[model samples]
Target: MRKILAALLLALFASTAAQAKWYEASSEHFVIYADDSEEDILRFAENLERYHSAMSLVTGRAIETPSPSNRVVIFVAGGKGDMRELTGSRWVGGFYVARAGASRAFVQTIRNKSGYPHFSTVILLHEYAHHFLISSARHSMPRWLGEGAAEFFAASSFDSEGGMQLGMPARHRANEISYAGIPPVEYLLDPKAFVESDREASGSFYGASWALFHMLIFDDARKGQLTSYWRLLNEGTDSLEAGKQAFGDLEQLDKDLKKYLKQKRMSLFRIGPDQLTTRPVTLRELPKGEAKMMDVRIVSQHGVTREEALDLVEEARKIAAKYPDDAGVQVALAEAEFDAGFNEAAIAAADRAIALDPSRPNAYVQKGYAQFSIAEEAEDKDAAYATAMETFSALNRLENDHPVPLIHYYRSFVERGAEPSETARHALERASQLAPFDKALAMNAAMMQAGEGKIALALVGLSPVANNPHGGELADTARLYVAQLEKAEEGTPWQPEEGEAKATGNEAKDPVAEGAAKKPTGS
Candidate 1:
């Protein structure tokens, strides 16, 4: 069953007492449906649950994972948006905790950012770590340690094919440090001190957090002291005291962790598209001797009559109709509609889910996605475009920190007209900054650059995704444009590249020559 928490009440309730309300913000409740392919929000959530349970068991503390009862949205977008949104929002890229009155909220927005689901899963786990920490502590833990513990947990990974392996320290943080500089260990120990400094510039925070946790938990000598240190922290140890108890020579441990993270080996668990399903219920069903349920669903969907996918959605909806208040049924119906490409129908079902229980953000995302799909199919130059714009605007208003909404908004602008091309480019740039490793978003941004006659810069953007499966087409298209640009620069014009790349604007250096060159090729 799905339940939506009211975001407004959550904020008000949270303001009164931090521990009283877990998920703050009652006005922002919605159900999030996990995508059934190449992603699994529920699996991510389950992993978090396991970690939380394990930690709580080990520490003898009531570690709370984010609310499983709330409507959680799971979806992917071309990683594209402001980096600050991901890190600054405190909840983005992690299992967020928001509450309204007695209700609660959670969301997991994982994507194929590093060209690998496993890597993204690590990122999602970090968020879950935060959820577990906050819930168990029931108090605002120090940011550095809280984030450090989250990072520590996030750096661990488990896979059926590869077994269990530790993940690398956050690259985002590492990059910052490499380009900028790191703070002293003393400064990091102080939560306020760490917060005051732009630790992002040095990337030291991520490494430092991981190092501290590793030494306290794994180092041979310090391992014996973990229990006491953990107990002290749980019992509300002073930051310096915790540091002193956790590691006798905290500075040395910090240096060791930094070295360990730098040298940590990561076996790229290249999970095939097959292992990357978003449906957790289906995945969990696998162990109960019902692994084929999802397969049956998929096969059943494929074997049915024309557009069987759509029919299956209708069937799910009909089943849901039998139980008017069954949030699960409503969510399932909406999922079916979404998978079937009945964007409008899916959106309506999602809306109904919200009406039944307004705390779920899943429905909001579904509604947003449905509208986005409709906008994609829009025919009219103005009307179709306007609808797409509305969809994106609604999405952003609901969650300013979410990059997915921004990605769609930027794309809509690019598709509709060049009048806002610059604005779209800026948005895309922000997306790249947030998720520098996302290929599709980068490709789109590069194309936008090319559209603005910044061909070299566009090529630079496209270079990153030149090898991935989804990026192959984009990479080829980008290369083709680069060739055309080079040819144009050399005064030897060639035929324009096809599709969006051909939409060259008024900045053509030699339109007459370009056209003449294409004329002969047409023959």
Candidate 2:
């Protein structure tokens, strides 16, 4: 009897092991383990989603990474040497490692941790874009277009009870092309110059790309020609030919671009820091009540970096010190601390802010972002996953055409081992639309489409990034998808274009109710 029981137990154990192996083998994605703690895993996973989303949006196809094998392994690196091994990456801002079939992404989280959330998301998006391009798309996009698009969406955001805002509005975004200060539109679209630029210039390249792309798509005539340009490129037409086929002559496009730039250059929003520094001040001393508090809040909400943000926080705190019960000052301090990456400090300030006035939405949003961050940084998978989801639900209600939160929401779902389905694709689509010029969002949507067997659609989406360095990887990936689609089995359902912004809130008219109430019109 003992022998029989022991054998049964052994058999049961073997069966369980086999089941585990089968589960891991079922999907192409490798689980990336950044650290032993659940917090770290959640954090790493959150970042990965944003990165992957950015990649697909940029390249206009799906990205697949194999290694750390079917699962991406994440290790908390001690120093730069370890980071080099993980990233094989030469990016300017952060440290990470990614290799085919490694299943592990060794990232350096300690050295410069300011934008870990943003950096991790962007880097993952970049590498994942490469994977999808090579494996599924079998094509290559330009490097400049790829990186520029990625940088454009690297700034993430989340919801709060108060309202929606940028996660890290690039400090120098407006500065990158100070109306008269930036290079001409020709230089921005210049493939060679884009490829040769150093790290500092990367932001400029992205800003220029965003501005140019936005002009191309939003401008009435150009929007309609988007599909034609893409089709021309796929047929091996040179960019000039593609432009001619899509728009008209190269000179016409140049004229339009230059004219648009002139209009944008003189706007107050485009003014440089030098101008801001010299601008006249309206108030000599701090005003009383709401006006004084609003001024302080504005300062806190505007800063872009850790140091700059902290300065705002200090000032807010000092004012709150003078008026201990001021809810706005506390909220301002909380927002600044959170932006600066002082999670604990942010929480403390948020608690005080809330205590002073719970109705304030800023307090809720700050606390929510902090909670989500903590959830990402936690060591427990269940806790991390749950926290991320909860925050996303709360955030979704507040966010409108804000792509950043959608990236986080999509990533949280992916981290829980979910497949890229309608829900994921919808979120991805919204992300892209929110930042129409963002290459990363487009690439993510394209990749997701390809994953769902929509290769043609993926190719169509990625066509925009075909000519530049930042988007080069995506172009490669889209080509691969098109080739595969041509040879794919006949039984597969035709891949449809991803969701449109027809269900709009801020960007459209009563889209939600209109969608529900209306019947489909025949094409």
Candidate 3:
């Protein structure tokens, strides 16, 4: 029955196709998708690669280039309005989602506003700061620090000579700073106040957060205060007490930030292209069918609900049939089919993808996903499970460090009501380390660790999620995990309800909260 359905879908798609002049920019840290001119796409890709380089070197972080499959996939949105409409927010110019082994972002094309980098680029840069910092840090931090640092880094620019500047005054937040007033010092230091505040206070939080961070980073008198504060917090001190110890009087610190924000000229860093060494960016006009399928591919990569999948699978099938020889098109079809509950059809499409392009990694992932979906209902569960493992094993061989397959390895056992092997748990931990920006993945691993009495490790995993400035259920859930895990470390393990593991984080199901860097209520 499934085979016949699959055949009918392909038959219906036999002559369907669409048109778009799209370009792909492949670089060390990014895979860029743009429906724009080649010259423009190339220029943007170069700037992205250089920006990535500058950030890594400037921070003295040794973040290596991700595997091809792990590079952040950036989509150039139609315009600023499209970005705003995604989350129904006037303030959001762009956003990113951090999926293990498959992070992606959508942004309005970079442009200048008032002789500075546009708000779109600022939002993108701000989100990337969250991406980069979370990937490297070992523990959670205060919400103020996270937003402040992101704001400070987001206010940046690239020059014609390939030079870059950082720490510019956040002119984007100037209005909020001037009008919304400073968020009281307690708001900056306390998580409860940060979360409980209403819309106007939220705006002031960001404005005041940036002012405080910029002051700490650039002010001579505030040297080492930021480090001291973070160290105290990490050492188990409460945030308010840490702030007092590091910055002396809280009121004085607030006053200092107000004074700093009012200054006419603020200091910033200027580094030439020589200081930001980057890998070359490769650009090409996408193949006809692949170019035509950009919209479908973008939606699939970002993930979909069953309803969304139902809506998209027909278009995917049409494109796949029109471009029967295109592996990328087949991959898109496979994902659509899988998401729409056509598991057998998904496997068939993924098989075609693998045969068409042996080098494409996602084909294996599509097959593996479908295999996992159907294995439970199979008459011979053992053989079905083994076959799915082989599919993931093939992907691991292709990219040894690919995170999803490692996560799949861990999930294969737990999902089957069996105890995971030591090897499986190690694979999951390694995946968490490689993709710490995937806060959900870390949260899952942390839960497993907490269940097994590894409280310290669990805390490390949950901290970043708790402090996520995305500001919603996921952060709230993570804070709960931290509280529980900290108590467990102190000899009181709070047992979680059954089936709570998968329901903890704000995943793709929550469209508004998934991977959002800054979600101010309004204004």
Candidate with top lDDT is: 3
| Tens-digit lDDT string for candidate 2 (1-523) | 1111223222322322221211011122434322133444443344344444433444466533322122443333323433332223244223222221122233444222333234444444434443444344433334433443334344433222211122233333456666334344445434555444365554466566545554564577677675675577567675445656766765666577657656632211111222211111111111233223433342232224455454455555565678757676677677767776787787787778778776554565676567666766678856775664564465455434334456656666665566645775687766554433334455566656656667566656555433323233444454444555566544455442345111111111111011010100000
- Against the hidden reference, what TM-scores do the models get? 0.39, 0.39, 0.89
Candidate 3, residue 149: Cα displacement in angstroms equals 0.6
Q: What's the candidate order when arranged by decreasing lDDT?
A: 3, 1, 2
Off by over 4 Å in 3: 1-19, 81-92, 110-115, 195-197, 469-471, 489-503, 508-523
- Candidate 1, 285: how far from true, in Å? 15
Number of the top TM-score candidate: 3
lDDT of 1 by residue, 1-523 (tens): 1111123112212222222211111111222323234234444454443444444544466521222322223322112221112222332332222211111122233442322244445555565455455444423345456666766666654454322333334554465456545455666666446442454633566656655655566556666675666567656575668768766776776576556555655322223223332222323222211121122222222122326455455556545666656554565566567667777787777777778876554455556666756666567646765665564465456545445555655656655664665666576666544433334455556666666667656656654344221233455565566566554542232345555453221111111011001000000
The residue pairs found clashing in candidate 3 are none
* lDDT values for all models: 0.45, 0.44, 0.75
Off by over 4 Å in 1: 1-32, 35-68, 71-97, 100-120, 138-140, 161-163, 166-172, 177-182, 195-203, 233-237, 249-523
120: Cα error in model 2, Å = 33
lDDT of 3 by residue, 1-523 (tens): 1122334333322233224477889998888888777777877788777777777776777675677877788987656454543444566556687777778888776453333687777777887887787766776668788888888888888788888888888898888888889877878898777654487777688778888988998899999998899899989898889999999988988788888877889999887988888877898788888776776776555555666567778878877889989888888888788878898999999999899997889889888988987887888776787899999999999999888789888877877778999999898888888888877777788777777777777777778777776636777777766766665653344456455533345543222223343210000
Candidate 2 — what's its lDDT?
0.44
